[model samples]
Target chain A: MSAPEASVAVRQRRGSFGRLFVSELQLVFGRRRNQVGLVVLLGLVTMLGVALKVSQLRHPGARGGDIISAVAGNGIFLGFAGLTIEIALFLPLAVSVLAGDAIAGEANLGTLRYLLTSPVSRVRLLAVKACALGVGSLVGALVVALGGVLVGTALFGAGPLITLSGSRIGIGDGLLRLLLAVLYVTVGLAALGMIGLFVSTLTEQPIAATVATAMVSTLLWILDAVPQLDWLHPWLLVDRWSAFIDLLRDPIFTDRMVTGLWVDLAYGVVFFGAAWLRFRNKNITS
Target chain B: MTATRGAAGRRTLWLVAAGALAAAGITGLMARGAVADPTLPPLTPAELLAKVAAADVDGMSATFEQRSDLGLPTLPTSSLPDGEDLSSAIALLTGNHTVRVWVAAPDKAKVALVDGSTESAAIRNGNEVWLWSSEKQQAKHATLDPSAKPTPTATPMSPSEAITKFLDEIEPTTEVTTSGSGYVAGRAVYQLVLTPKDDASLVAQVRVSVDAQTFVPLGARVIADDGTDAISVAATSVDFTRPSDDVFAFAPPPGVEVTEMTKDSAPSGTEKPKGDAKEPTVHGTGWTAVAISPASTEKPDKELTTILESLPEVSGSWGHGRLLSTALVTAVVTDDGRVAIGAVTPERIYAALAER
Candidate 1:
């Protein structure tokens, strides 16, 4: 092919992928229901900033030890705890919303048959769709993280990202920590994508896929919270959600980090692979 | 451009959060006369460090209370860390974490570890802080900081006297006058609302009983502003003697990988305890020990009865324990300028100095 022809072909391929990804993004953020969650997170970050600033204006002598002790003992932390904790609790659901709709949404819409009939293979198409969803969700997660930091800094004077242990990092450092924490949270959230993708492949109905993935995440959270279930503690995907907390430590204690990351990765692999397999076997005639 | 001790910062945090502007009717917690709210002014970063370095403990002794509202992590109840981030970090969060503290001057303190699920903390020696899990009986030891070298031949002081001395350093700024009546550890007690002018100076309200029969910390609150309370211990065995030489040293168990630091070190990303911020009280490794008051004096004492009134006939708890040895005594004056002696155990011999 001549240069223009080749460039045109490349442009066409890129355009097709971009269109597919945009559609996925629109499906999630484009919905009115998802906007509620988005606003909620935004409010959480802003309020967290306000709360922290108020505390400083009121009582600046507090210590890190006091904060750390409180967090460890009570699972209470500073800043939009309601929202941060919520994010920790529900980010998975958000990921599932997008991922779970992947193949199933297409199938339910009757577009899966048309796409499968093209020159593209079903497995490749599913992989591409999954990738697009994961990236989109990851970007959303970053947005949420940025929202928290921005508001937290504005209200708290960007002094430092204070932790439950009373340790702090200056504004620059705080941002860095927030970034790291968000990244970890993102990875954790991504696992939801894998599950969502799996459900999407298993069910031909988008609603069923979304509901199943959400139920799975909720069950994991319940299992993690119901103490005395030592036997099941290590395996629950939600248990890893707390790994981000380690990032708050002065030194960022990580004996659990390694384990948590591994656990999350394992979940992603199993669910993602299962989804890929299911999609490969998905019959278009049905 | 200033750094305050983390521990000190925490105490300061308590003081600030206390919003401890002395209101009316508060007494015992503060001196009787109106003390002009004791200069309840906002402290700068510099003043905080100076105050930490200035803390003096003759022969200190008291069970401390450690509390943190979730903006920060676990820290000493009375003494906070000397890190830069401490104040700002804690100021941003609402942590409902309280711990009961027990400190036996110059050295022994038990911190109740708070571990989200169930809090537990045992003895802490130098860098090795011990914590027990509620579900498990076996204790786990983690290294924090390396034990500092023992202080060279140091000054002598009495336990109670040292405590009083500590009291001198932190003259009460807040006061509480109350009509309500109550009891603590079985003693008839009057309540007082104490707001601190200098937050870190308050361990708890020094409640003095209205009735001569009760020594209920003079209507003081046993808790800090954070709602963290100290483990109450009345001088069950009041002795003015120094403990044997080996009391302050630490000898760890074998086979444990003493990573020189807690295994969680590098991962902590915990910035190295940045610049050496001046600490309020710098305790050296030199042997500093004091005969503790009765382990438990069920009822509060109306007043601090000395050896004269400390006699069993006059007081219940002060008389029974061990002999008040004065000679092995290190004549240490308390913050109030009252003379105190550190004595050996109930076993060894010493000159007995009856309270002046």
Candidate 2:
């Protein structure tokens, strides 16, 4: 082919990849299951906000101005409290549902083969799927947080946030911290999403992939809970799930949060790399 | 096609190998950083125990910080009236507190907890004891009876007193060993580890750091069976010189509210129950000692009930109750309104209750 035609082909390829990325995002988010997961998460955050408001009202004279009670006085803190309650299990489960289904669900439905037959490179295809899963996980986290903010503001109203360190922060700064907390939690869940994506690539059964991903997350949580397993704490994926608590501190402790980010980054690289290598070479029989 | 697949498999294998190597290296680095001095001379279990038992320091004052991460469920504090200070144990376990303790031997000692801007102090000077809270601007005066035994104060335990209590409870069921050496407050110390032999006990080990030269316990940590530090106390700074007598003497400021407790009067504002009714009845001895007591008259509040409901229930010949088990402590409140708390297991607690 001539040089001009080759350049045109390259432009067409880049354009097609962009289209694929957008289409992949829509496909993942358009799923009923993923939507239901977000709704359920929102429901949980609402329940938590209501419970906290009721508890605060019932006991007006609670001692100590700790962060948990700070939520009762200010709606902005509800986002932090909601994230704290859900990061343990529900958030991961929601992310897993999307991530675990990203690849395996396509294969289960027998559409993976058709997708592979397209002019798309296998690497680009996997990258798009991973990005879509990452976006899905972030949205899942935001749904809970935004839901918390709305419900909390309706019940408790917004005010200056009283930090765990006993310092008060204005509503604007408190919301900024809340945003950082949400991003931090999303990054952690995205790492788990990569693990789920890797697990999904190994099996044709979407349910099995989801279950495997959740089992892995649960195992990490169990390891974190065991004090005798201190050797494994630094390496466990969920070990720093609570590190977001540091964001609520007065000076904002970023040491643990930074370490958690690094841990999540490492997990994402290794697991996603493994998934790519495996999927790149696997025979697409489906 | 076959050769291409073979190459792909080889690449995947190498990728996994590299990942494992990186993980192991990181873990190794972390493990190395956690230990202090690993090459110290090893003391035999018997020698270590003897050293600990003989450990004593006099006329010393230390400023210490304590942190407790027991992972305990929150309990309601509604039973405690407003303006009443938290019990020392609760305050110590709940948050960070800087405590200055002065021990001048025989009967003179003082402990002051410094809050951000306020200070609460308990001073025992000869027969006169004074409790002062700057936040409340109140002071309580109690005169000790010369004939009656000295009553234990509700103040947080001094590091020396805590070490003495731990040493007194040593039994054959304890597996004692020297963990190695470390520095506490810039002083070289030997770490002595004591592990309970009881399988049901949540206490994995109790580590006591002894000052190598003075044999003073500079630090002590209670490690639960799960490996988490349930309670840790360390002297951040120490001065061997005796604090002046003025440190132990207290005269309330003119504007502060003063409540004087005579010998017959009940202890004012102190959460501890007065008289023998509050004393826990010890059952068994050593590592398996279970302290049984009548349940508190204060009802469990909403929050405490929720926490109790979350705990697993255990039933035995002694009756049914919920058990709160941590790494080093197990507490059981039975259906009969009796409470048994110990470092032993729920079964052991039940067994002790049955013996009663």
Candidate 3:
């Protein structure tokens, strides 16, 4: 083939992968179960906001220096409190649903053979699925954050925000920090999603993949909580899940948060690499 | 097909090998990053102590971390109304904390204890002192006598302040020696090891790292006899330059509750009824000393009572009491209400109570 024709063919393949990624995202979000999972996440956030508001009302003068107690004073705290509660269970559960289904669901439905027969490379398909799961994780975190912020503002009303440093900040700065927190949480969930993606490649049963992914994350959390196993906490994926609380401080402690991001990146690399290797060689007999 | 299959298998093996190599490389890199001991001019224990005494630092700002592994049971705070404060007070004796401090020397200092989602700060500017809690949205201010010496409350927030208490017991009880030189908070420092001469003492040793040039203490650790860290406080980062003046200035934030306290007036409910309160009596000296506070007339809280009841019961010539023994400290609480505590063995505490 001539140079122009060869270049045109390469461009066409690039465009096809772009379309593949878009379709993958649509496939992830359009499913009824995935949509329900997101709504459930939002519902949990709303419930947290209402519970905090009710407790604040019941105990008028009660004082505690936690995110839950801070919710009464600032509507902004609802987002913080909700994310803190949900990250341990609901957030990981939601991400697992999408990530565990990424490849396994397609293979289980017997569409894997058809997709392989198409012009797309196996690695490209895996990348598209991973990207969709990344977006899914981001959406899951946003559901909790935005849901909590809206419901909290409606209940407590927005005003000058108080930082953990006993100092006050304007609403604009508070919202900015909230945005950073959302992104930080997104990275953590995405790291867990990578682990789920690898598990999905290991099994043709999406249910098994989902359960295994959820178990891995839960195990990390369990390891993080045991004081005797503290030496292992730094290596656990869930160790810094709550480090987002540092963003609420006046000077903003970034030591743990930055380490958390690095930990997430490392997990992403290792697990995604494992997923690619597994999927690249697996025979799609189903 | 067979040829391609063989190639794919080879590729898989190569990739796995690469992954393993990468993991090993990263682990090796991190292992190498453990800092080596920094060399400094050698000094004897007495010279180092004198240097710390004469050292003067005008102003600085720093962040520090304190960790205590006292091997105490988790306090039952779930059912308590003042659970946050109760747990926070207990957390000071156990677990880990990060603190930010700013000192402008003569009468201007601020220490912010940063916990999970809240901060409590104590700021002293000239004759005025402020205690603020972000969680409660409250600030308490008190004006001190201008003529009184500028002695802030004794807070073990810094390595210098925390180590000073142990340094006071440097007489015959502590075997002082210079272990070596090293680095703390990125500054070259000398390690002064204080080993308790008494075998009954639960403390194995106390190690303080003093800044080589300035002689200011930058880190300290208390090792228990069981080879565990009882308490470790260190400056994670530091800056010796004077902090900005605005950091010392304080005006209560708009929404916070401001309470002005009069001179010499303790907060209501905190002051014990004067005549009934007996001063704590000390039995022994230095590391093995035990302080016994007489039985209180006031009723102990239900939570405190529950905690006390959970301790192991012990009876001897001292009479029956609950004994709480940790790696670094032992406490004996008699049924009649006397409590004896010291960094000594349980038998020593029991013996002290019997003598009393």
Candidate 4:
């Protein structure tokens, strides 16, 4: 083929790949279950805001940097408080639903064969699905945070952010911290998403993949809580889930936050690597 | 083809061997970081107790480090006296802190908290006690009654006081034994371990380290039933030589706010009673002791009540109220306006209340 024709063919392939990623994102978010999950997450954030407001009204003098304490009188801290609450279970569950359904759901529906018949490589398909899950996780996190800020601001009214170290910061800096908190939570959940993606590749049944992913996440949380298992604490994936609290400190403690990010990155790399290796070699019988 | 395959297999084997070596090396370094147990003569429980009871040291200065993981809610700083540095008190309740203490028996002592870049010191010189906060540029003065005994209460501000208090409160209900010997602050010490006889007590063991030479307690550790250290205080460095008299003397620096506490006035915000509240009374004895106090008439503000309500509720012969239980401590607030708290279980607290 001539140079121009070869270049044109390469450009066409690139354009199609871009379209595939966008369509994958839309398909992931377009599902009824994922939509319901997003709504449920928002509902949880609202309920938390209401509970915190009621507690604040009852005890005006309570102190701490916990979710309830942060949202008591300062609505701007709602994003941080919401992130803390959701990162425990809701965020992981949401990410798992999308990632667990990524490949397995396609196979279960008998569409995997058709998708593979296209010019797309298995690696490219997996990458697109992973990217779709990543986008979904970030959106889920932001929805919860935005819901919390709206509900908390309406009820408590906006005020200066009071850090865990008992220092007051301006609204602009508080919002910036809130953004960083949302980003941190999103990245943390994406690590869980990677695990779900790996599990999804193991089974043709979407439900089994979803359940396995959630069970693994819950097991990590349980390991983190068992005080006697001090050795397991450092290696647990969710061990530093609450380290985001350090961000609310005046100087912003980054030791645990940095450690948590590294742990998440490690998990993401290993799980994603496993998923790629498995899918690359597996016979697409489904 | 076979030769190429053999070469690939050998490379993989080498990779695994290198990885295993790295893992073992990391584990070895972690193990090496742990404190090494030292060899010493063993003593009977009775002999160790007698030595500790008879132990007394005068005119010693030391830098003490304390770490507490009580899991208690952080108390509001606004509730404390203005410019009163209660970081030590907060540290005792929650995290870790370091302070330098100098005690010259008969009420001459000083405790300086080593905060970053600045320090706060509480000095007791004869009948006058001064608290100076360098960061806040504030000072508080209190005059002690000449006839009043020079108890540790005069300067009950250091973490060492907490350790000393624990050592002094050893009860007959504890099964005392010498666990082993170890080095602390570069001094050879004997570890006298005490286990609670009461099964209801949350404390699994309390370990006290006594100096082999001076018999003074160089360190104390409170281990919860869950095998986590709830509280640990140790002297990182010690000097038996007498602290200079100037160490205990203090004068307000220029441009500092000075507050004088009189006999009729409360010294700290925490000391002030809400209204008509009597001092808490101690009940029972030993490991299962409970402090029964009258519930405050002025209820905790809305926020605090919510926090209290969030705690699990327990009902029994003692009546229903909220119960806050941690690995090391349990606090029960009875419905009938009484609060019982100790290192014992709710059932033990209920039984003690029934006796009362």
Candidate 5:
């Protein structure tokens, strides 16, 4: 009876969830570094678009016997590869920049104490921050993908989206591919988000959290690429994330894809579970 | 015991996780196991060929459409005008039909590419003898029999040699299915969709129309990864009569610029358009001809203004993509290795005039 009443009382005290999310959004995107990542992402996608345009113009003969051209003319090859090349091995880094710094940046600014001093429970704060970060990541991924597609279509013509694999997918299929790529990449980066969030909780400076997350994620990727250590392939975070290519194949293969998504989700769970356990009972005087 | 327990716990968690992921994936494949493993009873090479050879061939004509992801060919796709050789051959076998292949010789022939598609290819390799046009360049040579295996000199791996190779993969991926039925090229064609059991493959489905009685596949549609229908090739005309051996041979006419494909040829089109070639290129009119389409839209979209301005000074030839695709289709369909402009449409004539 006492537990129920305490829970009801705590829930009532936090005010509306809407007000909380609004504040969280402001805190996440309302920073200079987020703007920097955004600018970098835009510039990168723009470069990819320009490159595709110039290459097509410069080398017409180079197209024959080229599978990319055949598929592109029939309207299938542009969007999938263009997006992947523009920002893979690079996505996790951007994610780390924003998420890795979330909590640590707050703690460093000495504003963390304000939250602890308020009636906010540790779990509520972690939940709100994660949700906000997820939204931000979603926005970032969509912007890059949309920018790539828009530019690719404008310059290359809105042909069908061809795959590296030997299949010619149409235009509608291209949009679906774009959505899948964005969603999977965003989910694949969730572990980084949690790692960044956790590191943020421990450190005062956001840069430390950001760097730590990028270092760990990238190191795991490098480890995954080492073929000799065959046994370690499945365990590392990067191993599971490699399924991003599956989305581009002609007939969608969901078996490996779904499995990868779940593994990513598991990583997020473990990270959040650890964060919850660590910060739930800790004191914050900073 | 306590240390052992901790290790065991970790091991169990790992085991369970791995097992769960694998099982989930396999289960999905099993649940969505709509594609039949058609090759349940695989046939040997000889049986597949005899079945195809004796199939009926007459005035059956189809608007054969062959699409390659790249202008170049890959895998079994390397040999067929599109991805039909396998399905057509399979239909010939179990569906009760036969299709004949008349291999072309490289020498004693003068063939040229009539169309100008950047990536797709169409080559008149041997006069009316043997025609070679590929979406891509793959090494293709001919073999004496289906089971004889391709030798380095006569491998049928190139797009021109696709007709033979297409029949080869068919016996492996096909099963006698009593599914959809249809007619193609004036032959009683039975449409059997071959379901390749490899779940990871991009070929989601293949819809082939085989002569219902003859079992010769007259038409087929190759669906790509994006669920878009990429290629639709149909047999426009099939002549079962044996052609002269000289059909495959090619010899350039007198005073012709026979560029002995140098060790270092300038890079072709970047999916290259023929008009933009850095080196001297081939022109279409010299070899054989009639405007197949006369309609320009079927051809490559080159900057004619640039070519026109450079006219008399331009190094290479010009053609359209549609013409390339058509020349390729005609070569495969007629099998005489000799495809001249059989028919001409008015739209194509206008397009041709503009290009000229």
Candidate 6:
């Protein structure tokens, strides 16, 4: 196609980006791996809730600051507990799967060329993929949180939330805080997705990209544990993922949470930029 | 096609540059403090000390952070059950703590020690005091003697209270000077530097910062002889506005276990005084003073014995013992069942242990 003709074609199909994003979502959710991953998450949450309930029945009155003990008192805590647990491993894995597949899966199947030949610009295609990845992370977080709420409230009725400040807050306010926690976690996972996207652009093998992305994330966590690396903790992407717990405080301490958001933004911008830089000018022989 | 490819490459490069800039900006912003060094009229150290003593405020609310890097190994608190007083107290010695304080003049106050998902609060309303712990889901209530009366010297719990205690120990062995002025919790503060004349003292200097106008202390830093901040406590944010009356009032939250106790029945000190151990004896004066106390008659627990054994053993004219030396303190456990501790060098501890 002539350059001028291609410009006209891109302008004409600009409105179809939303359709492209929807199709991308369909592709992500339609895959068997992602479907099973989500189902396993729900199953794990249910088992966790059941175990907490049983332990409470056995011990009767156990109390402490840890999440497991907190779960015995309020059902809402189950949501927090589930999210904390999944964020460590499962949710990141789910995000890595979709983001790692964003470009490489298409190329591996020899469909990237067909998609690029259409009226869509390479940059536009990446934007759509990023949006799809964002939605995928959100869904992964929501499954854990919603499942926790459903199972938790069912097992132990919801009422006033006892705050970290040892004060009582109404259920409405507690739910709002829980929602904020989910959103915060989604931001961290989306940042991880961006890293996966950058790694996805580096290779044509989807499995290799997924494994590398997951390893990069796990390595950040490991480095965070080493005392000598304290200087680098603030820069690590996974360092503040647990800052969501701050929302449960009486007046909510926003310092760490604010820093967490900034870190996520920085990672998202840089890694997404890297992915675009690598992918936009690549040969589409596959 | 080449032209389009070239344009795409340029756009991607620009995007990468923008991303890199954003990352650097965030890092720089995190490292930068909002307030710069504050300017204030000069005041001699003696005059500043007097100002701090006379200064008083009716009401205020603040969030403060305290970090004590004592070089002591942190005992794992998570595995221990909640309300294990010893573990919790030890945990406080080696980590960062954030506390929110609300005070209204002489009669009422509340302090909440907030951890990530748990809170422990002490609220004082009139003659009543309530201790609440969220993690343990427990609350303790006690009533103080109403006739005890509030003394004019009674200050609310703040950095000011702590600074006064440190200032009271000043003597000829200490040299005081005004270093400079800076900001604490966005308030202009005059810094008073206290240096110990005794070279044997582990503390090199103690810096106390007080609000320029009110003279209320906003922060304090204890610098070890090695020049490390052994204990740093500062107010991150503060407001002088009167806190709401309801803050001091405490009602046990739903689902928590509440215990009632008379003033006499309430727990006082953290450690019980052993029947065989005599009163602790103090030796020397001012900065290098050491307190020698009788060791507990009961045998040390397996864990404690192991920890004690891990310390380096020392022998001198003062006799043989295990030495525990931190940046700000040196401790000697003598074979004769005496424990001497002080913020002084091992030589001072030895002298104290050898003294009749």
Model 3 off-target regions past 4 Å?
A1-16, A47-65, A69-73, A117-121, A226-228, B1-33, B50-61, B77-88, B104-106, B144-169, B185-188, B239-250, B266-276, B294-320, B335-337, B354-356
What TM-score does model 6 achieve against the real structure? Answer: 0.89
Residue B315's lDDT in candidate 5? 17
lDDT per residue as tens, model 4, A227-269: 5565567577898777776666544555457767877766776
Looking at model 3, the pairs that clash are: none
Per-residue lDDT tens digits of candidate 5, residues B1-356?
A: 88966865675566456556655654453243233333223333343334455565432212232333312112232333323545434222221111223323322222222111111112233222222333333322222233544456554354324535555555454432335444444345445565544333344566766554454666777665456554565553444443454333433322222333322342221133333323322213311123322222232224423322332321112322222222111111111111123112223232333344
Question: How many times do residue backbones clash in model 5?
Answer: 95
Report the first chain's TM-score for all candidates. 0.77, 0.95, 0.97, 0.94, 0.86, 0.94
Model 6 docking tier (incorrect/acceptable/medium/high):
medium
Computed on C-alphas against the true complex, the DockQ of each candidate is 0.01, 0.05, 0.45, 0.03, 0.06, 0.60
lDDT of 3 by residue, B175-254 (tens): 88897677777788899898999999999999998988888888899999999989999887788888877777777776
Which parts of model 1 have CA positions greater than 4 angstroms off?
A: A1-36, A44-83, A117-119, A163-167, B1-356
Measured against the true structure, the TM-scores of the candidates, in listed sequence, are 0.43, 0.55, 0.84, 0.52, 0.46, 0.89
Better of 2 and 5 by lDDT: 2
User: DockQ score of candidate 6?
Assistant: 0.60
Question: Given the true complex, what DockQ would model 5 score?
Answer: 0.06
lDDT of 1 at B212: 16
Q: Candidate 3's residue-wise lDDT over A1-286, tens digit each?
A: 9999999999999998998888888888899999999889989988888887788789886767678877777788788888999999999999998987898888899987887876678878888888888899889888888888888899888887777776678988888888899999999999899999999999999999999999999989988889888667767889888999899876677867877787787788788889988898798898
Cα lDDT for residue B257, candidate 4: 68
> What is the TM-score of candidate 2?
0.55
Q: Is candidate 2 or candidate 3 better by lDDT?
A: 3
All-Cα superposition RMSD per candidate? 25.5, 11.5, 4.9, 12.3, 20.7, 4.2
**Which candidate wins on TM-score?**
6
Candidate 5 chain B, run of 10 with poorest lDDT: B329-338
- Score candidate 1 by TM-score against the native: 0.43
Predicted complex 1: DockQ? 0.01
